[model samples]
Target: MVAIIKTGHSIRAMLNYNENKIKQGKAECIGQGNFPVDADRLTYIMKLNRLEKQCKLNENVKRNTVHISLNFDPSEASLPKEKLLEIAGSYMEKIGFGDQPYLIYKHNDAGHPHIHITTINVQENGKRIVMHNIGKDKSEPARKEIEQAFNLVKAEHQKKKEFKPEPVSVRVQYGKTETKNAIENGLNFVVNNYKFTSLPELNAVLKLYNIEADKGNENSRVAKHSGLLYHALNGKGTRVGVPIKASRFHDKPTLKKLEKKFVANEIKRQTDKSRIKNAIDNVLLRNNIIILPQLVKQLKKEGIDTVLRQNAKGLVYGATFVDHKTKSVFNGSGIGKEYSAKELRDKCGANLEKLKGEFQKAYSRDDLLNMIKEDRGLLSIDDITKIVDLLSKTESTFDYLNKDFLKQRRRKRHRRGN
Candidate 1:
């Protein structure tokens, strides 16, 4: 069972969308409880007719729509419509949907049961209301409540639970030496072979009679049959994990479990990235490399410009450069093959050169050079070699082999061996 609240769309648009879902008939309507007894049902009937007068009756109440859907394997015993309506009413009362105008219409046109609901966001007096947040709030609790009320064991425990229907065991008799009377009894034995929890178990039973079980197709109706999922448990037993197509399975717990797994993995990924960032920051600080503030100041001093913009890659730091000859808006990257701040500034000619000179005069070159040297010295000869090799490969130039590097490697190797 899942409850979804959607806002920011007109009532008519919402009605049409729900009407399409209802026409599929995958789920049954459970009736509304918020308004006068027949008022809720009246809206559902009226919405189906697309009657303008029916919708206008409650238009001034500032409506917001909520749809509640329940999905179960259809092969199992279905809850009676009267019982389903009772369940819906109890659920609404428990969740506090308020005694306002709301309708519950079951949709069975699809592959499963999804209930559509329309309600006023405010009470008859027109005060704003807070609704379910779905993943962030409601689904998990609702699932637990339903499982308890229905006396169905959690899906994980399906293997240990008994079947809901009477126990059926099967026995196989090989060879036909037994009389025709024995053959009828053997057939009875095979039909009672419904206890198995998995498809393989069910297949084993079918093999005895020389009748091969039809393996359902990818998109075929038989393939998506809900009964296969519920087959794990017979008499309201635990539900073994069964593959259900998106169209058939909509249990709240299943949805929450999926969301929980997704959120947990995402959180771990974000934490790992944070740790990586922290490690990089520590290395940069220890090596005295130019920090972000220093890099920004350097660009500003060099007369490099920047702007904020949104692109296909999302919100990003961007910049523009006017072509010197055409004076047209040219992106910073187009000013040169590489769009580094220094390269962009260089394209502005003498004024940029003068600015660079002024910037250089304002900072101590000795200090910046010392920082770079310190950072370089902090790395081992092997690390430095790897870095140089990477840069050489990228540039297609072996100019990275300076005399200082050869001396360091030779001295380091000698020191290691000694």
Candidate 2:
């Protein structure tokens, strides 16, 4: 089972979306709670709205509406309706919203059966349930428990079979083309699925599908002025068309929205630190692994993005891994000394400079042999001498590349010549 949560300002919009599905004969009301009157669509929305107005909360509390969906694997089709409801209720209880008034709608509009949940996040006392790291901190653990108790397929296993959003399909916004719809869906997918620490790390996953949440420059008028601009990006990081204000996006993935996510993701990803360490171990265990880019490309398939932190002189000083699956950021040192940025060159048996650009990662012995076919064949005695020179320079990669020292030397040489 997989759970996705969204908090918004309006309960009416969510109630209507599910109610409209019922009107279309595509969905049916399964269960509801905390309504003053009968739990029909009308009373449901009225009671929730009355409660929100009664609380008299300010607009700053953006999570007044809680919209979530629980998706089940197609293989679990034979599960009884009673167990499904139990699971839903159990999940809600574990996620810290069980006591709150909520409505459940099971939709058969798609090939597989799934359910939508709607509830106001504000309590009777007018306090909002904390939304920070709700997904990783709460949902993931609850999901594992539910999956075990219900005997369902694991989500991690399902992820391998799922198709991620494509770049071109997600970026185009012509003539009410699914651009708007796609962005909303894609944002939900990325937020719920990938564990990202910071905005740029999150954007790396978002931009893959041509979507970006640009906060503008720190000194720029947009940042000084305050607000977020979400725009479509091309295959390049450039904007494809007009940008949408953060407020304009339905889910409102504003800086505040994402900051909450980042903090949550940081905590959530820690539980899966071992998973990342295992991935690094798997790649390094390969006998022919020879470059950083090759390892980086392979790690992407595992839903891990490797960021090589470099200085102004183009020397790598650190490495951070954005584990999208876990939604965590880890420094190379944080994981282990062996996996640190400085350790990678020695670990891969490649000089730092030679590892730049692109390199082919070898998966098999034959593949490894084929990769070096373009190389100058096997190394002779002369090649050995050159290899030693590279290794000596590789140990102190910053040599002759320090900008300050290089500038001083140039000035000194000019004065002496004059």
Candidate 3:
């Protein structure tokens, strides 16, 4: 079991969040604590008023509301609702919020089975419960005890297990699922899990699952208002359906929310920069002469997706890398100059120059062509093209020494004499 505790200022906001989930059929209010009526019989206003009344006792407590989610492993998904409520009650008591007016919501949105608990730290006597380091001081010990008592999978054990993002299992195939649900699921997976700083970087990750976040053109009303929309992309990457407004989603992933995330991810993705840089450097190091396509193939093998940005003239001007292993996205220039598109092209060009020098010093044009023809399997098309280019640079010398050129010249002389 893993317990995450969050504190905010609005109890109504937290209640409404869970209530909205219930209305969407993604969650249900299954249990309550310190309430006069049973959990099922309690109305939305009843739940809100009960918590609000205690909150009103301490007007000084700004951060009075507490929202906790007790997440269980997938193996324990079959655990009955009564058992889940029991676990929530115990967890709250251990964390010192058991006696407070709270509601337990069984959320069916995520892959694992988890329940959300909404409560307040403020008590009836206008005194606030101590909320300092509550997770480390109280919740940690509580989680371990609950794990052992319920014979549930340990959080440490679950940590050792590899986490596959939910989006990997299913992609948004147009016309298959509701557009809103598809976009929501894709956004939930990427927005919460991936560390992306810019909108383009975020799109690099989103495009993998056939979803895109757009703010319209610069001159458009949506862009002028800083509004954003998410659209489903067809297999060819064209927008296929009506765009869903960002605000329409539950988490409200609006432009403002994403801008905040951009700032936070900028700081979060710094430690991960070296991982991507090293991956690119290692690929270049191993293959002394590699083009962009080969470099992309090698990085994909290392669990990184390289997205090359090109202009209308087909010139690659930018590069973005998505590292699946780390769940981090980085622009090439963000990592360093050498990883940028221009610098990368220069590096590949430099390798070709080196190969040209080696071939010039080692073999003549005819000898190089003979070598290539004799060992065609050993060379890539790029290698053969490079050799052909070298031959072209010395075409006069090649013709002077060629048997085919001599035969053609002699035949032309004979025809003229005739």
On TM-score, the leading prediction is 3
Q: Which segments of model 2 are wrong by more than 4 Å? A: 3-65, 76-101, 106-113, 121-171, 174-177, 217-222, 236-238, 267-293, 300-320, 330-418
2 or 3, greater by lDDT: 3
* TM-scores, each model vs. reference: 0.33, 0.57, 0.72
In TM-score terms, candidate 1 sits at: 0.33
For 1-418, candidate 3 gives per-residue lDDT tens digits of: 8787878887777888889889888899998999999998999999988999888988999988898888788888899998998899889889888789889999887677889999999987789999999989999999999999988999977741233334422345454334566567678668877899889999998888778899988998778878798888876566875787776665667787789989998898889999999998899888766656667778999989987776654456788999987889999988998788889866765665675555544466676667466644333455567767877776454434559878898999999999
Clashing residue pair totals per candidate (backbone < 3 A): 21, 2, 0
**What residue runs in model 1 are displaced by over 4 Å at the alpha carbon?**
2-5, 21-30, 35-63, 73-77, 110-112, 132-139, 152-418
Q: Write one digit per residue (lDDT tens) for candidate 1, span 137-215.
A: 6555665586578653443344211222222122323222222112222322332222222233333333333322233
Clashing pairs in 2: 195-324, 195-327
Error of 3 at 197 (Å): 2.7
Top-lDDT structure, candidate number: 3
Error of 1 at 51 (Å): 13
Whole-structure CA lDDT of model 3 = 0.79
